[model samples]
Target chain A: MSTVNLIYFSWVRERIGKGEETLELPADVVTIGDLLAHLKTLGAEYESALEHQNVIRAAINQEHVDHGDPIAGAREIALFPPMTGG
Target chain B: MTAPITVRVQRDDFDLAAEVAALTCGRADIGAIVSFSGLCRDEAGALNALELEHYPGMADAEISRICHEAVERFGLQAATAIHRFGRIEPGKNIVLVVTASPHRQAAFDGANFIMDFLKTAAPFWKKEHRADGSAGEWVSAKDADDAARDRWTLES
Candidate 1:
């Protein structure tokens, strides 16, 4: 088993009621898809924000990654909106 | 060899010209400058007032990454960005992006690119302040903003 740090920003945080958390995952969860599935089980707040994949953006260790990317070696996973920065 | 970027999160107004001078100082190759200022529109007609909030450390770090990518994508010499968090009144500036380059085209493209990416990629949440004095609901992210950002990936 490995522990991963997750961060939710903006409305995701508002909806999820948290900014960051650490999770312990089974070794079978080796990819972002696996992680998303695990997160979807956390309850209504997590389900609502993540139910629609289009609105959320993901970054592993501070660099953006696609949904199909592997998360096996990731230390930090952050999710937020598409982005609105200047 | 020094840091070529500046990023800030504040509630105060900024002087555009002064900031630009600081960015372009001692760099003779910088022949052009372009900047964009995002303001709170009282009558955007779509939403009332907007309350913007951001995660302190995370917001700054992500914004710096976006600015760095903008500099490379547009061949810019330098870039500066500032975003104001908290309750902002109508007609107030909310964000600013300034880019400098040897050519007008790079400067212009860099500024536009940064704004487009910011609107779609930044992590700020807006709570709409309605006209009735009672707060309106949160404004969902617009598809148009996402489309605007997509155009860039295809072009470059």
Candidate 2:
């Protein structure tokens, strides 16, 4: 098991009610998809924020990665809705 | 000589003329300078201010990376981008991108490139504050912005 720091932003943060958290990743949670699935089981807030998983974007160690990307050795991960910046 | 690249994500407003002058002043080689400033709009008089949020570290890194790419691809003499966060009233400046090159074409293209990429790639979000003292919903990502960014991919 590895401890990973998860950060949320924007509406995702609003839904989850927190900006960041630290959690222990089970061995089965080896990819971003798996992590998101595990997060969905945590509580209603996580499930609500991650309901539309396909629309959410993830960054592992500050670099954007696909959901299938492996999370091995990742220290930090962030998830948020698609960017609306200009 | 390679031009300097400046990327800043701050809460404070920036001075456009001063930024451009700092990049081009004393450099006779710069033949043209182009700039783009994004302003906060009232959204048809429905909003009092626009609140912007961003992922601090990633915002700076991503914007800097794209600015460098724009500078290299366009053969720019210099490029600078400044994005503001926090509550910005309607009519205030939201972002500034300035590009300088020996020719007008590169300067123009570089500035355009920076703006296009910044629209989609940067980790920033905007929420409207309605004029009636109600908090508006978070602004959703626009397909138009994604389309604008897509054009650059084909050209590159």
TM-score of each: 0.83, 0.98
Q: How many backbone clashes does candidate 2 have?
A: 0
lDDT of 1 by residue, B50-83 (tens): 7887656666776788789988777788999999
Candidate 1 TM-score, true structure as reference: 0.83
Query: How much is the lDDT of residue B50 in candidate 2?
Result: 85
lDDT of candidate 1 at residue A38, scale 0 to 100: 82
Which regions of candidate 1 fall more than 4 Å away from where they truly are? A84-86, B1-3, B26-28, B44-48, B133-135
For model 2, residues A1-86, the per-residue Cα lDDT tens digits are: 99999999999999999999999989999899999999999999999999999998999888889999999989999999999877
Most lDDT-accurate candidate: 2
| Backbone clashes, each candidate | 9, 0
Tens-digit lDDT track of model 2 for B1-156? 767999999999999999998988788889999999999988789899888999989999999999999988989999999999999998899999999998999999899989988988899999888998876999999999889889989877
Worst 10 residues of 2 chain B by lDDT: B127-136
RMSD of each: 2.8, 0.9
**Native-referenced Cα lDDT, model 1:** 0.80
For residue B101, give model 2's deviation from the true position in Å.
0.8
